[model samples]
Target: MPLYLQLEARLRHMIDSGQLRRGDVIPAERELASMTGVSRVTVRKAMGKLVQDGLVIQKTGAGTFVSGRFSQPLSELSGFSQDMRARGFTPGSHWLDRQHAMAGPDEAMALGVAPGTRITRLKRIRTADDEPMAIETAIVTARDLPDPSMVQDSLYAAFRARGLVAVRALQRLRAGLATQQEAQWLHLKPHAAILRIERRAFLADGRVLDVTYSTYRGDMYDFVVELTASSTTLS
Candidate 1:
């Protein structure tokens, strides 16, 4: 490989193997030049590409560092815990709040419940390798899920245990400015950019299983999407 390409691969490998972590600053350009016996130009070139690829971040007065990472797409179909495990990261949740409450107007409408209907409201911060990745506020109809203590690291897992089908999901994504409470939980600053999502998971029989509003740190997350053309035949 060419010199710059070689450097890029090394940096990427460090990130892949967790030798370098999200938000961990790297050696300075001059220091990297000395260590690699490459020119400052070459070192800068390598770091530049990494930043462009979202593998690293650069602050004006600060040096280059690993970019914080979070699961993009945020699809329950994939199962959040499974995805994190696949990446070799320990997934955990520190349940901050759990309570039974009446559904609000929006949540009631989403879950096809009366405005005053009871629901289980659970608040948690999903973490990977003990780093906060997303803040989740979840609501499920008490009629569907009576006991809230049964909640665990994965909501879908709890649903499956009860044979509650979560077949399809409707989700909306928008950009939100972080609030003070959200900032603290997600380890972000107040008013920082966040990826906001409101999702309604459905059952095979078309029952809404749960509704969740989640906020992910923008700098730490990127949603990946793939599109393919469909084939058709004339009848």
Candidate 2:
């Protein structure tokens, strides 16, 4: 293999195996060149490939660093707070918009409610360890959230308080182009590819609990699903 390709593979392995964690600054090109007995041009080429692959980022006058990439199990119904905590990261949210409005077409269809039914819509910038991760918007029956102010960190926690725990949920995931507003919130350039997820949650009593639409930074989030084979044969 070429010298640059060899160096690129080594660096890629380090990132994949967590030898280089997210936000960790990589050694300077000169340092890497000396350490690996390669020319500075080879080192630059290796780093450039990593940058193009989104495995690392290069900042002028700063340094190259591992990019943040989070993986989530597609089969599970977990909230943002739960997911982050399971990863040993602090989860937080910054409220963007909170108000009561009549259910729109999409909201009404998802929640199985009338078009004019009042609903509480909450929008926030979700964070993990103080780093922005996603833009989330949640719509719930207004009756369930008489006082939206009472909701603080986790919306799930607030629902539990009202004896409205979500017993099940259906979700869909898609790749979408980020709008200007979404890009601004996620700190990405306009038209950046993002992971768009929509979910409809239900309570034990068969009532629609909430519907949520979230856009996660594509470079920073992944959806994983496991498959198992059944013993029964096809007839």
Candidate 3:
């Protein structure tokens, strides 16, 4: 095996075994080279591969550190709170705004409601283990969710309590750069990569339960999709 690949594998093992942890700074290239009796070039190459694989992150002058990236599977329709709990992270939210308001054109269209229809708007910064991860804005018709204040952390939980559970949802994702406000909320530099997600959740009766727009930090979050071989056969 190549020296660099060997080093990379060793580092990966350390991380997996918890010898290295998220936000833990890695040894400098020179120190790693000295400790492993490898060339600095090989150490750098291994670290670079780790960065590309999202196992570590490099700062301009602060050195490299283990990353705390979370991956969510697109095949499962679950809420952020549930996802984080499954990963052993405590999910939290800081309310930015929560009130009843008239649905705008886009919200109305997404919710299949008339423009100016009354709706409950819930805007908050979503957190995992007390670290901000995304900015979420959710809208639901007043007829469905009469009180937005009832939602303390997980909107899905509130909906379930009200017998408005979402059975399925249509979600769309796109890549973008974070705006200044979004960066402030997510504690990232302006223009940092972000993933924008828009989802319309439906009840078992086919009513739109909620329309949620979320912006997640690209560096801290990953969306995975599973694929299988197509059933179609070539002629």
- As a whole number from 0 to 100, the lDDT of residue 96 in candidate 3 is 95
Cα RMSD to native, each candidate? 5.2, 6.2, 5.1
TM-score of 3: 0.77
Q: Write the per-residue lDDT of candidate 1 for residues 111-224, one digit (tens) a residue.
A: 898998999999999999898888988899887778998877877788888888777888888998999989999888899999998888888888888989888888777775
Off by over 4 Å in 3: 1-21, 24-51, 57-65
Task: Give lDDT: candidate 3, residue 149.
Answer: 78
lDDT for residue 212 in candidate 1, whole number 0-100? 91
The candidate, 1 or 3, that scores higher on lDDT is: 3
- CA shift at 235, candidate 2, in angstroms? 12
Report the lDDT tens digits of candidate 2 across residue range 102-172.
99987888889888899999999999878889999999989988777867879998998988788889889
For candidate 3, the 10 contiguous residues with the lowest summed lDDT are 13-22
Provide backbone clash counts, one per model: 0, 0, 0
Q: Comparing 1 and 2 by lDDT, which wins?
A: 2
Clashing pairs in 3: none
Worst 10 residues of 1 by lDDT: 68-77
lDDT of each: 0.83, 0.87, 0.89
Query: TM-score: which is higher, 1 or 2?
Result: 1
